[model samples]
Target: MKSYSTRAMALIASAGLLAVAACSAGSGTSSGSSPGADQSLSIGLVAEPASLDFTTTDGAAIPQALLGNVYNGLVKQDDSGKIGPDLAKSWTVSPDRKTYTFELVDNAKFTNGAAFTAADAVFSINRVKTAWTTSLKAAMDVVAEAKAVSPTQLQVTLTKPSNGWLFRMTTRVGAMFSQTGVDKLATEPVGTGPYKLGTWKRGDSIVLQRNDAYWGSKPFFNQVTLKYFKDPTALNNALLTGTINVVGTVQAPEALSQFTNNDKYQVIEGTTNGEVVLSFNNSRPVFKDVAVRQAIRQAIDHKALLDTCFAGRGKLIGSMVPPTDPWYEDLTSVAPFDLAKAKAALASAGVAGTALRLRLPTLPYATSCGQVVKSQLEQAGLKVTIDQLEFPAAWLTSVFKNADYDMSIIGHVEPRDLGAVFNAKYYTRYDDPTLQALLASADAGDEAAQTEDMKKAARRLSEQAAADWLFLLPNLMVADKNVTGLPANAITESFDLSRLARS
Candidate 1:
């Protein structure tokens, strides 16, 4: 399996020439790639993008899958994790590592037929600091200024040397958008990508059509539709009946088994950068006690979660970063499962028999894991009430943004970007000046120093019992046997409908 960073690199790489090379005529053979007929596809999305505004969107899966196809960034990363050119065909960095100058691709144009230039890049990146995306401001906090040096040239100055700047550029927050289309982006996004948004039937489905005027190599499929199914059973049924060519997310152990065993389907399983966690809202009265947090961490079994929740498909994670990631630390034994230790901690915290609210979104894995955790914590003398929620809107408005729950079980899906959640200012509410400082050092240092500091930060978070770090989430794509060009790994670009085909 490729590491999470490697997967992210490929995801960003697809925003550049790599995607064109992947589906071009000489690359391979598939029904969609054939010269004669115009191919089409229907995909079942686990959920819709929270909003069409990619710059401020928070849902991990849909944004990662949709951004690369709908928007373009200045730089991209290759399979080997080397930085490459994307919308900005070339760039030069100053010795101080604070200023970067990029040469934009002149041929690129937005879906509205407006030309793309350095001015658009400047406006788009600078938009991060605006009130529209306040939650994501920290990610680009180091960027002091961005300006258009010329029609096709752009310059960006940073507050400090940032090792992760290029990685940050790979995210949707850094994607360039036409300044004129800013008003319409929230409802209908316009970008210089392979496909144009066709129709979005609010809760039902989204349709995308190939952009005939696209600057890069043409995608194989003429049209692609992403359907949404609220129930996992209904989603599975859609796939089984061939109503949809692909089922985007499938984490249930039984569903995984059924899909893998069924010869009629092509089941692809691999590790995503997503880390499933029993996240805590530290500001809450119950979680404010360190002993209570430690007790909950000790009560749950990481290995058993892998076995029960995922059927041993994912890896045991000690922290937010997965083991496959470079900055990961071997802290799996940091909080071992011990019922006695858990009981003692709960007793010390004076919450041994107190009922704690455990909020869970509608995801199958989360609901299933919540049941297991409820039982384990109950056995350890900790009471838990599972509050299941409707996805996207409910979770986004309450649990994620408002920090309305005491504890919740969900996966943080972006890889090499865990820094976004480390601060108390953004929902998690576990604040430590030492951690923030260490992360700052990591962000400014060289690759080795960054890795070391990140590891230290991860250790600090785990030692504080900030959250119960659970198993790494796996990406499982179940498709019809005839479908082709399904992404090899779970990355931002893995679900690019443009690459798929009916073989």
Candidate 2:
């Protein structure tokens, strides 16, 4: 979970204007094409990227739209979360596991017309440490050196053996950038992928056009439009009225019946790494007490909360690790919902009537879940207040950067983001030396030891009640019947457009 900065623009209220624009832009019809051979596609999404550049902007929306669509990485994670070759055709690890050598693809070229070579790979890897401003850049800090041995070969050596380094390369940190195109990354991007940025209408939509000179297999659609919607009903309506082909992120799960019952549409229900967390600001005096934190965790019934807030569409993951991770465990028994235990813990801490704030980002899940949390905690004899802050901007400022809230809720969507959220200086302000040591040990170990250590770290976080793991967000998507190659699970930040096709 990288720090979501205030840079992401707010969603403007002009649904009617967008409806007209989308109908013309996303008709999925191309000149001289037959009925079933649509050359364009439109997808409804909740969030829009504030900027095209993920190097400076800290949010998932940017990469979700660009990564694997407009940009290609050295490596990429598939639907199952396995690392596979992208620009780099193949790779090998040294016996020591500290160095990685890559075999580059010669035919690939950046959208800017620069050849994708080892030098560009080295430059991209090195730029992350020297120039990237987002917290995700730290993943590249392990690189001791990235050198190009030849036009088709690249080598990267780490300071130490890291099991997670190569996997992290599948993320935005690994996106290959052209040296000549670094000037306008925020407004214009250059990458070697199947699609190129076509048009971006702020507060409306971003259209990606197919690169006719693409190196690999041709994408199914010539154009893909990511249409933005502030309200979930609008997103659903966009699909119903034939304005869009797919709803990429289903915001309102309770209204899913409208799509599920229709034969013309297909509803995809899968899992994501998004853990809708009930975050407690551990730095605050009232939450600093372990008993208070545990009391809150014990008070809320996770199942009921999930049922009420999310329409019981997600998983009850008791820790930061989602089931997709290798080290996942069902730790729900750790702090089961118990009203008596919650009251007893609050009384023991002498903070029964202490006033606490549950500040929430204006995300659908947080707003819906905040009510349940307030009701449950109030029953446990704790005074609670709910504050709805505008997402990305106000929420990131007051809750994430300033640490001005007692409690908050936001979905941590980045893959395998346990280390980022629990970081000592992160918004949660949970600084446990033992947990840090465990994470460090996990990163520097072999595959077997890494999984064991990560499991231990997750267990430690759950037992200590670092934060209440509310529920893992379900990857609920609604697409037209003709849309093929839809990913069942969302294991990465990118809503990869390369695999989608029309039947």
Clashes found in each candidate (C-alpha, N, C closer than 3 A): 0, 0
RMSD of 1: 4.7
- How many Å off is the CA of 237 in candidate 2? 1.2
lDDT (0 to 1) per candidate:
0.70, 0.79
lDDT of 1 at 464: 81
TM-score, candidate 2, is 0.92
The global Cα lDDT (0 to 1) of model 2 is 0.79
- Write candidate 1's Cα lDDT for 148-211 as tens digits: 9998999999988998777778666677788888787767888888788888788788888888
lDDT of 2 by residue, 48-106 (tens): 66578888766677777788888999998754467889999999999999999999999
What C-alpha lDDT does candidate 1 achieve relative to the native structure?
Answer: 0.70
Q: Residue 353 error for model 1, in Å?
A: 1.0
